[model samples]
Target: MQPTKTNIFLYLVAILVNLLSFSIGVSITWITSVIPKVDGSTITDDNPFGRLLTASEISWIAGFLPLGAAIGPLAVGKISDKIGRKKSLLILGCVNILSLVITVFAKQTVLFYISRFLAGVVLGSSYSVIPVFMAEISENHNRGALGCSVGIFVAIGMNFALVAGPYLSISVYSLLCISPLLIFVPGFFILSPETPWYLAARNDEKRLTKSLLKLRNKTVEEIHLEMTSILEVVVENETAAKAGVRDLCTNNTLRKSLLICLVIICLQQCGGIAAVLIYMPKIFEAAKTNLAPEICAIIVGVFQVFGTIVSSVVVDRLGRRILLLVSSVFTCLTLVTLGLYFRLNLSDVVWLSWLPLFSLVVYIFTFNVGLGPVPWVVMSELFPSNFTSIAAALTSSTCFMNTFIVTVTFPYLSTFLGMANCFFLFTVVTICGAIFIYMVLPETKGKSLQEIQKLLGSCG
Candidate 1:
């Protein structure tokens, strides 16, 4: 709590690690702004591509990112465990840089698809590695806030893409987004320390001691106590043999943790966040609001960033379960309202046209407050250090898979069922998700990693 050297160091590292989220945000949301321009617009003589993309090509460009992301985490997760979190993150940065380069030079639809797919790989890698890195480096009290920083930066990235994409050409936007990756790659290398938890798990006592010293402002006794706690969990994990997919499935605690993680991520995706983000411009276009669709998207992105900042501030104080429960309930309500607004718009309800915009803003805000970040934070807290990589990979993969499904099918589903009916279905899912969380999730405020592990283990 005091402004010691260690505290300053940890906060600096937290800031650096969270920058990865910005690249992720840009990658995922870039298409949202880019698609409208490239889909139907006339190509100027000066334009390098010289052709507009077809609808089917746009769909592939949109859908393949998550598909590639689904594959990225599986490999990156294992690589993170084998190498280290820092190195894995650097690799992600490299991937992002390469993807941007491809995007800049890409003249063909296939090249665009490949660039987007590569971007997805960075996203998948970041989601898998960054949580583990934050959890291992942060003190118990700071863990939740640091974990939620990922969401904060992600929101910032989304907003940046939304606000800038309309103004800048695709090439300019791609180049601008690469700045963060460039800064993050070297900045992290110089500033960040390997996590003490990771060092202990790898049986490197000297580095573990050094890492603990850099991360903690406590006395030698307190540092020893913390080291012992981490070691006990590491030893217990080792006793079960090497941690893997089988260990995650066969061990009772790890299994429960994996299930909870997967369920949370599924609910997070199915709750319609991806659908809302992907279709924001279309939604605004359909609503025929006074503001331009791009402007409305910027507003929504601003709200999202604000909500994530609020979540970072209160996640430790309010606790995870309460925020998630509250978030789910309110999000369901907003979705229902949005559904009704869309349904009414189909009628002669001209005066209530503003409801869609209002409801979506509220919905995005509520989601970022809890459901957006808490699930990832809880996922990091749930698994032991030994199993964190594989579990994170599996969970991150599941999240992206669901995202892919929702992203790919949303246009068709909304077309067939109508936007109102689509949202109505999501409302039902939100309700179910709320009930599950209230009945099952444990409060993880102020608890150490080992304590949380024991608490979860005892649940079985």
Candidate 2:
């Protein structure tokens, strides 16, 4: 396809929105580097806080973000509907800025908890809004790649945190995290246009036309045809007067989409990703690797970024189902091997020590290729525009809740069930998730949103 002015602009907007995901990535992983510093026994006199934090305090600080994140989607979803997606995102970007400022100046443990919670709120709202915005603005042929940008940006952010956090002081790291938002906020406000779908839904004819003109490089006739299709759905949705939980339950197609989304998101979180990312340093510490723990964590982040880039490149061509199936199968095998390695390590197997780091790298890679990115991409594609904000909120909430549960409990689970058993459980979940994907999960490549609805409606 020949590139047009509109195509170039669309790519630019996609990159801008994905930057929000990158900022979120930094916020989410910031604690990973900071925790070991605060949790250590020696509270150096130069430390800003000038006190060592208790394990319980550190746990609460780490866990509070997901808890706050779970609430963010519920509130931000409705807000995004009232205000446009672009403005809602801008507001959330400011919220992230505020949270970072709090992190920089925080002297008390409660302040740290509050800052983390605020970061979680930003995460929830960003995940809820950005995917829908990207989906709405993108052409069908390239929507999958555009949607997968969330994962790519997130990987970038995580990589930044892993690489930078250990080297900088807490205040300096917090400042660095805020640097991206400075560009994202004003840049999005000044450069980006509101999504045509959102404008059409509000019945703003002049602005809608302008948006469609800016977003598409087609002839006037083609633009009219595209606008007509969007307006038709908007008019149909208007009769229902705003989608809610009732709509989700009463509409069979919507309900089916929700089921598929919920399952995919649950599997994504419950498959042990959040725990693995949060505890990566510790895992490296225990694995008997010659590399430093920070270096291992950075390596894992690199693999994650690589995997997401691969997904973004191939998702449009190979489609969602195939990649997800591949991800699930390899993830299961890696986890199983990791479990067995840990099990055998207890009996003095010297050669198996390298397996944990190797398994973790492969597992992170496999998870990012599909389970990490595809679920959110699918979530954005699955729901109608009218229902997307609310549906995504509920789905994002479920994801954060599961993350909270997994992150907070993983240590205890490791202590009680043993790390070997923990991996075994994750292995089983991955197998079940792969089976679920095989049985369900229709291919969404190159399908318009309305076409997707019809496709789901036809499925038994």
Candidate 3:
């Protein structure tokens, strides 16, 4: 069925808000552009420090972002619940801009570490709330597609950094990254509407009406019909005491939902994506590819973007379960081949030099199509509204923590174990991931929040 004008407006708003992800994408991969320049091997015009950083320091620079992100969701959860998702996002946008400004002006290694950590704070918080905000405002039929938009912008942002970080000065590149939020923060405040779910939860019927009016291009009767559905949810929620952290364990539906999200997110991170994305140029260099590492990185970034865009188009139509299963299985295959390519590259195999590039491209594309996006989509869908913020905080924290471990340890692991061994380890993890998905996960396509909760409750 063709979407209504309301659906189009919903999509436009979702795309705009996800500009936050674009900024994050730049921050995440900014290391790719600047790592070489700052290693003290050559004093470039843009190098801010006179001293060289240790290998450990460089890893911390990469690690600090996710480490800070691990803490951000904790605060953002309460803030989002108390103040509302829209305002919480605005606060994060402002904080994100501040972190970027610090990055642009940073002169000392300590200062750079602080700025990166703060940027990670924004990353964790944004991931915690953004998908829930998107889901809360959208209908069940289109929620998967909209949630997957998050990955598209993230990939685009990563591509932006990969493309621009190589040419721009460190300060100039950071300022360019900040430019999105300069528009996004103000535009979001003035143009974006508060989610009806938040308004309903607050029991502010008047504001709820205004929010719906702004979001939906529907007649009053149609708006009222939707409002009725939202109110039913709210009233149902009111019947129970407000959900607390305790509910996450005691409530069977919530416990299951949280477990599913955590496992999927863990699988997503352990697949070695964090290491590949943050250290893309370095990974290509390690593999001894014929293409310029920069060119190869950008090619992978472009493929990442294209894959996510395809995912956004097909997620609602295809159902989440199959996409995830296919994504995990193929991801396992690609990682195995990538590991083998790296292993064989050791022997001066000239004919198979092309294998690394082909394997990486397929790996990146397949990863984005499903595993990259589906976990977040499932995370957003499975929670009850009352416990969403709490569940998101927990899930977001776990996601970044796993990411931090993988990203921080990658250099040492690659050096000691060899890059091929690292991919082999990720391949093993991916196989386990596929098994988990097949054994436990339910298809959430076209299901309402209530329906999803019931489905989860019934699952073994």
Candidate 4:
């Protein structure tokens, strides 16, 4: 067998990184479904909070983790820049354990909110740190797959949480979802190693050597040569300051990257992804169905896994821009159709008993194809290393805000605008998303991060 750049140890570490992301996915996804158990259901509109409150409160609960997770990529990116990705991951592991301890015992909405908020912080961190870890460890040919593995694992974590969460009763059973932490905590600790890029960033040769030995134990010469190439790339791309908001804004290239980040993320949430993912049951009711919404939830979650798997497989081969464009076109059609279907109240036709379910399934498939995996892939590819994490944070923050607005607004929107209008509104927004992506979004596949930055840089 040909020797591989990724050693068993680094592969294991990458797996740990994926596991952390997955656990976060499960923790975040599962608990979100449980929030209404305390907060109340939107369909009935009779929570401890008012119906509007049920919307507002659930929005707060649902948005917190992503909001909190938004902070992570920036924090871990910086920490990884300074300490190392492995150490950063380990610290997050500790934070995960601590946050869960608090969440598991949380009594009130406030405490629960804090737990979700803090957990989001950790989630964001994992997103930032793990890719850097993977990119640093793998050879160029393998990096894309390795980077994408994070998505697969993320789906795995989310799906596991989805299947398990609804099956178990809420409250304590909900709390038990934290168990991924136990598996991840020890698994990341003993099994995961520090990212070599991190070691090189800090100029920790000894530790870098150790990381090299762990990932590629074949020869010190091979390790040294590999480290040199990576460092040269890093040095060649080195900039004057860290990836501050100012630098991101003032520089035309960085600004475009930021815009891409913002637009794509906005596109992602505006697709009404949260409605289906967060409230599968509510969406089914919109479809006027007798089917189990929970089953649909699991189904949607599974689509994410499979869609991401497909994207990971074909992203390099088919190219990023085409996939995005195709994804957007399909989504536009689905959203409009879904909107009109509800608008026409076509759910009750004898032959179309499963219309809502079908719409949802198709929507899920299209979403997973277009918005689910593409945004993150784009974000990671857009920024240079220095700006990568904080850029991720900024991107994540904007995305989550859009997400927050949509989630908080959906219930009220459906009531005020009417359900048909709501879906139609989503359709309109998605159509616009397709246009913006075509016009403004840059193609990044098959280019190094630095090359992308150069291509995006202003000529004048």
- Ten contiguous residues with the weakest lDDT in model 1: 39-48
How much is the lDDT of residue 266 in candidate 1? 89
**Per-residue lDDT of candidate 2, residues 1-460 (tens digit):** 7888988988888788877899999977888899778867688532567888876787778898888888899999999989999999999999999999998888888898889899999898788888899888988888899888889999999999999998888898999999889999988898888998899889987888878777786767779988888899989877855588998988888889999999888899889988899888877776677778898899989999999999999999999999999999999999898788777773245666566778889999989999999999999988888899999999999999998998888888988998889999998888888889999899988888988888998994
**How well is each residue in 72-168 modelled by candidate 3, as lDDT tens digits?**
9998999999999999999989989998898788888888899999999999999999998999888877789889999899889989999998898
Clashes of each: 0, 0, 0, 7
TM-score of each: 0.96, 0.97, 0.97, 0.88
Question: What is the overall TM-score of model 1 with all chains considered together?
Answer: 0.96
Off by over 4 Å in 4: 1-7, 35-56, 70-77, 239-242, 458-460
Candidate 4: global Cα-lDDT? Answer: 0.70
Question: How would you encode candidate 1's per-residue C-alpha lDDT over 356-408 as one tens digit per residue?
Answer: 77888899999999999999999999987888998899999999999999999
Task: Please report, as a residue range, the 10-residue window in candidate 4 with the lowest summed lDDT.
Answer: 43-52
| lDDT (0 to 1) per candidate | 0.87, 0.87, 0.88, 0.70
Q: Tell me model 2's lDDT, rounded to 2 decimals.
A: 0.87
Between which residue pairs do clashes occur in model 4? 68-120, 68-121, 69-120, 69-124, 72-124, 72-125, 73-124
Model 3: per-residue Cα lDDT at residue 200? 94
Error of 2 at 141 (Å): 0.7
